[model samples]
Target: MKTFTKKLTFYMGKGHIVRDITADIQAVVNESKIKEGQVTVQAGRSVCIISTIEYEPGCLSDLEKALEKIAPRNDYYEHSKRWNDENGHAHIRSTIVGPSQTFVIMNGKLCLEPWQQIIFGDYCPNEHPEWEVFVCVIGE
Candidate 1:
């Protein structure tokens, strides 16, 4: 079995941001030279998440709205009370969305539905928008 790992970083604006990372995961799979295997993509922080979602603008917008409804920012949370911060909703959103996703690699390519794209979503409302995603490909 062969394994390859890559760390990716990017900046996201305030509010909710979803960025597609399908190509990046494929790149790691290609580098690993694994014909059939599995790849895991994980977010490095609690305020961020990795999942599959439609990359279209409308779908992305709706996802953001749905998340807002699930964890409204204006609501009070014990997490914020403890830290004196305003991103309690970010934590809730990330927990619901999850922090990692695993995908199958077949024929040296990611096996995904045409419309299902891997996404790195940052729910933090902070000024420093840097986020990290780790990709690990394993198998032969």
Candidate 2:
């Protein structure tokens, strides 16, 4: 099996920002030249999440609302008190959403539904000067 690994960097603004990264991951998979295998996309931080979603305004809004209901930023978090930081909710959201997603690579392309796109979410309450995403493609 062959493997290709790459790190994608982004300057992220304050909390609750989501970006579509399907094309970026697909580019990595294409560069790997792996006709059949798996591509794993991972966030480098605990406060970030990697998952699949429909890249659209309505869907994005819905996701935001849902996450808010699940983990309200205003809620009390012991982690915040311990760290003297206000990003406890961010960690919770990241844990729930997960930090990585693996997709099949078929014919040198990422196998995903037309509407399903990989997304990276920054949940930190503060701005991140640089956020890193790691992509690994492994296959024959």
Candidate 3:
């Protein structure tokens, strides 16, 4: 078995930003040179998340709206009450959705659905200077 890993960082300006990282993940798969395996994408912070979603205008808008109702950024979270951090909502949002995702690598390509795209979503809009994502690829 062979294993490969890589790390990436991004500085999100905040306010519900969704970025497609499919290419980046694919790049890692290529770099790993793994013919068949699995890759895991994870965020470094608890306030952010990694997941698959349709990278379309309408679906993207709906996704944001769903997050708003699920874990409204403006709502008061006990985490914020303790830390006095407005990003408490970010914690809740990430917990509800999760912060990491796994994808299969086939023939050195990501086996993703047509509409599915990997992305890092920021539910909390803070002046966070940077966000990091870690990739782990392992298999034959």
Candidates in order have lDDT scores of 0.87, 0.93, 0.88
RMSD, each candidate, Å?
1.2, 0.7, 1.0
Model 1 ranges with Cα > 4 A deviation: none
Per-residue C-alpha lDDT of model 2 across residues 43-87, encoded as one tens digit per residue:
999999999999999999999999999999999999989998899
**Superposed model 2: Cα runs more than 4 Å off:** none
Cα deviation at 75, candidate 1, in Å, is: 1.0
Candidate 1 lDDT over 1-140, as tens digits, reads 77888888887767467889888888888888899989999999898889998799999999988998999988999998999878899999999989999999999999999999999988877755577888898898
Q: What is the lDDT of residue 134 in candidate 3?
A: 96
Question: Could you say which candidate leads in lDDT?
Answer: 2
> Which residue pairs collide in model 2, if any?
none
Q: For residues 1-140, what per-residue lDDT tens digits would candidate 3 score against the true structure?
A: 99999998987886578899999999999999998989999998898889998899998899888888888878878888888878887888888889999999989999999999999987666677788999999987
Better structure of 1 and 3 per TM-score: 3
